[model samples]
Target: MNSSYEQELCNKKLETILVIDDSPTNLEILHDVLGSAGYEVLVEMDGASGIEQVEGNPPDLILLDVMMPKIDGFETCRRLQANPSTKHIPIIFITALTEAEEKVKGLALGAVDYITKPFEQEEVLARISLHLKLRKLNLELDKQKQELEIRVAERTSELSQTLNELKQTQLQLVQTEKISSLGQLVAGVAHEVNNPIGFISTNLHYANQYIEDLLILVRLFQKNCSNPGSEVEEQIEAMDLKHIDKDLPKLMSSMKLGTDTIKGIMQSLRNFSRSDGENKKLVDIHEGIEATLMILQHRLKAYPKRPAIQVVKDYSVLPKVQCYPGQLNQVFMNLLANAIDVLEESMIENQYLNRKESTFINPKIRIATTINKYQVIVKIADNGKGMSESVINEIFQPFFTTKPEGKGTGLGLSISYQIITENHGGNLQCISSPGEGTEFLIQIPF
Candidate 1:
């Protein structure tokens, strides 16, 4: 009893083999050989019982007999191979028939190899060990395959995300270049306009004085010598001298006003296009906002379809801020321009629906500014069809836009957001909802 217990304990540490056969003599012989070779052998007398034993307690290898009572080894092998849980277990067929056709049939039925009826102890042990090693190697390969596939999937996702970021960076560079080129062009145009305006303004001042002196001389002559000659009187009446004397001064004043307005516009253009290079400068924040509004004046004028969009300014006195002047101007321009666009669209919609009388109030943009010790705040609000919460969430994302495809490049707000948050270390926030209107709040450090 002690020897049997010790043997059982030793077998527990060895590889287990399940042998299925009908002949007790063959089972006993094979079992003794496998047991002596350091393998734990399990025996079953029939194919059905063997299948049950395998399901109840799995083993490392299976030995099936070719000739059996109820079910032959072929049918048994087929049954085990058909089961998913048993399919991977290695099966070696034991048979007495040495026919080539019979061997081929046994191998085809998923048996790893055939053991002749007169079992060679060495051959049986060797075949079982070889198939066991192959099974272990296959499991390892499958695990490695799974790990490689997971790694490949993770790498693909990372690369895809990187590709999208690169695309956005490229587009942003293109946008920056375009803005730079446009600024240069605007600066050049403003410079050109300045010269012509200077000439007209200077000459108009002298021309006004000269015309005034000539008028004064004529008045002196008319006052001192009323009857200088009949020809002079006739000429004065024919030329309508009184009307010219009164209207000429007013016309010159109007001309002067017109030139002054043009000069102001040119100055605003120059201010808006001022490039600050790589350095910051102390600048009037209000000046930047004014310049942007001046540039967008044409869009604010009363159109045939709608009344003029009103801009109400509630500016608080603010000290000059040290910042990138050109970029700050760009942010203001983007925000104001977006407000104008939305207002214009809303106006058109109102007119098309003929709701101007009831629903559409005057389209207006309200701009307010305030300053504290830590930061300066600017607010731009418009009464227009606003965005949903979902849209507001993605507003700062590059390439996100609501404008029609060709009408907008969708870079303005994203670039503006970067300029405020990343460039100036400022904060930009939006508040909006459907049909309620939209408001953008900008806060910049002192």
Candidate 2:
């Protein structure tokens, strides 16, 4: 427990009692009686001294003598009551006056109760015990109220934080959906343009070859002819010899290559934009994994002296799951991309320490899929630097990412979590440790 809390408990355990009287015998009796009852007793000889003591260090209860030299009990009680700081302390008057008016006056002066001269010991003890219990109860009540207020404030703070996080996650999801829709439209346009491009590319290739042959024939004719016959001149003239033959052929060849490259790009776009729906089909998960691998091929390839990490597929024979294939493909894409990022960070760290000469040994990514009686499970495991216990615990929380700013939006796992749990009625979980690599297990109902 915190030191402040422990200190509070100790303070609560001790209760102080203040006894005010002019007579030494009376003060001694009050102190001894209260002290035996487990209260710390403070004694004052006169009303003036008692008021000072109460103001300086307030006690839980005060026992005051009504009659005293110089400053009297009524004036002291009035002083204590006037100040808000010491006003609430329970005060009982001890007096020798036996008249009804004297008792009435003491009670009117804010004394809670009165004890006449030659006080009964049992009665004095009983009244003190009763008032002390009441004081302690009041203190407990105040403490409880303060504690309740603190708890309410803390809960409100947590709820506000959660609400803010939810709003941010919603905004990111909207942006991602918009981008995905745009990608689909671009893919469709690219696919439609591919057919015309293919035809144009083929035509350009054939035209270039024809142009080359005509150029060779013209050169041969020119070399062979001197002051040639009219038939040869007619033939050269008919072939349009004055035209820029070399330039035209080169232009057509360049156009062909350009169109062919565009066609390939379009094909890649089409594959990437494939949609997921409620349509259930027999899908080979391995094919989707391979497609995702191809999409990220550039990232996997090493540059300069860096060694590329190998991807190992260990797919088990399993029944096809009845679910949206495209979404599953996206899950694979995200997992593989995250693994690549971790591995890249490791490689960069190694390079920073002048260790670039050392080659990475068996830096690999493994993906496996299997089907049980009720569910199909896909496990994507990576052998990159793993997460600690804290990271692993909060990995699925929305907008929680280990990647640096601008490198990640931190919504991939959050969205993936929503998709698996809400959309598909499945579960997504992670198994990881510090040195041991992480594995995400995704289970979809059959």
Best by TM-score: 1
Candidate 2: deviation at residue 55, Å? 35
- Write model 2 residue lDDT over 1-446, tens digit each, in one string: 57776677567666787888889998888777766656689999898889989989999889888889988988999889989999889898888888999888877877788877799878988888788788778879989999999999999999989997776579457535844784678676876796788778777778778888988987787788777889868976897666665476667767877887677566544554466645666666666676677778888887666677788777888776666566666677778899988887777766676664644455788888888888888898888778999998888877789988888877778777776776679999999887688899999897
State every prediction's TM-score relative to the real structure. Answer: 0.68, 0.55
Worst 10 residues of 1 by lDDT: 352-361
- Residue-level lDDT for 205 in candidate 1: 98
Could you give candidate 1's per-residue lDDT for residues 23-103 as a string of tens digits? 888888888888777778999999899999988898999999888889888998899899999888889988899999999
**Where is model 1 more than 4 Å wrong at Cα?**
1-157, 355-361
- Model 2 gets an lDDT of 0.78
